[model samples]
Target: MTVPVADDWRPRLSPGLVLRHDRARETDVLLMPERIVVLHGQASTVLELCDGTRTVPDIVAVLAARFPRAPVGDDVGVFLERTRKEGWTR
Candidate 1:
């Protein structure tokens, strides 16, 4: 799959997948066909914003505002690329 560029890319979590937050374990997980992806904190935040309506840049902006101390764009971009490769987003 081609990695989506940040500008015109509107990302949505893959269909048939469910994001579950485990409070007791303090973890986030993605459930998909025969697969489970454990998500770290920043990954959870970024994926929550991938609602099919927001471009990558838009996501970066929101994250930037919410986390004024961290530079998150590059990390988000890398994560999105990995997700795209793994067929976790569209």
Candidate 2:
């Protein structure tokens, strides 16, 4: 089987915000009352970074610099994987 690249499964983005919708988390699911408040910080930042110019690695790099306390390389990789699978990129 072929290996997957970090940006492999995600859709293409033109511009603007890309929202993350989670099925299990009612807060992240659209129309839910909580409305992603629990993930208001990092997760939102992750989603917003999916611009055309920034690859998955670039996104991680920028966030890493911005948030020294946050997990960078592997963490952003995982989050991007999930976001890609969930069709959040496009």
Candidate 3:
């Protein structure tokens, strides 16, 4: 079953999952058991903030500040929801 991400939700990487930079590939990666998911674009940035310390709005605020002209609120919401469904974030 899929759960909808709430504005107050504080998302974090699931157990046994780690985010890291792959210098060889010059890209970020999501490391999980027997799996290596290559992260692209703002994925790494979004995942990095999913440390369970900040709520969805808090994260969106930070990203919005960093990228003033971008639609961070909607983008972050969609991204978080997708990641949650993929079992990447909890």
| Count of clashes, each model | 0, 1, 0
User: Once superposed on the true structure, which residue ranges of model 2 sit more than 4 Å away at CA?
Assistant: 1-4, 7-41
Task: Quote the positional error of residue 29 for candidate 3 in Å.
Answer: 0.4
Best by lDDT: 3
Taken over the whole model, the C-alpha lDDT of each candidate is 0.85, 0.58, 0.91
**Any idea what lDDT model 3 has?**
0.91
Answer with 1 or 3, whichever has the higher lDDT: 3
**Per-prediction TM-score to the true structure, in the order listed:** 0.88, 0.58, 0.92
Candidate 2 lDDT over 1-90, as tens digits, reads 222455533334323333556667744421223333345447767766765567766777789999998667767777666655654454
Candidate ordering by lDDT (highest first): 3, 1, 2
Model 2: weakest 10-residue lDDT segment is 28-37
With a 3 Å backbone cut-off (N, CA, C), the pairs that clash in candidate 2 are: 27-36
Please say which candidate is ahead in TM-score: 1 or 2: 1
lDDT of 3 by residue, 18-83 (tens): 999999999999999999999988899999999999999999999999999988877888888989
**Candidate 1: where is the Cα deviation over 4 Å?**
1-4
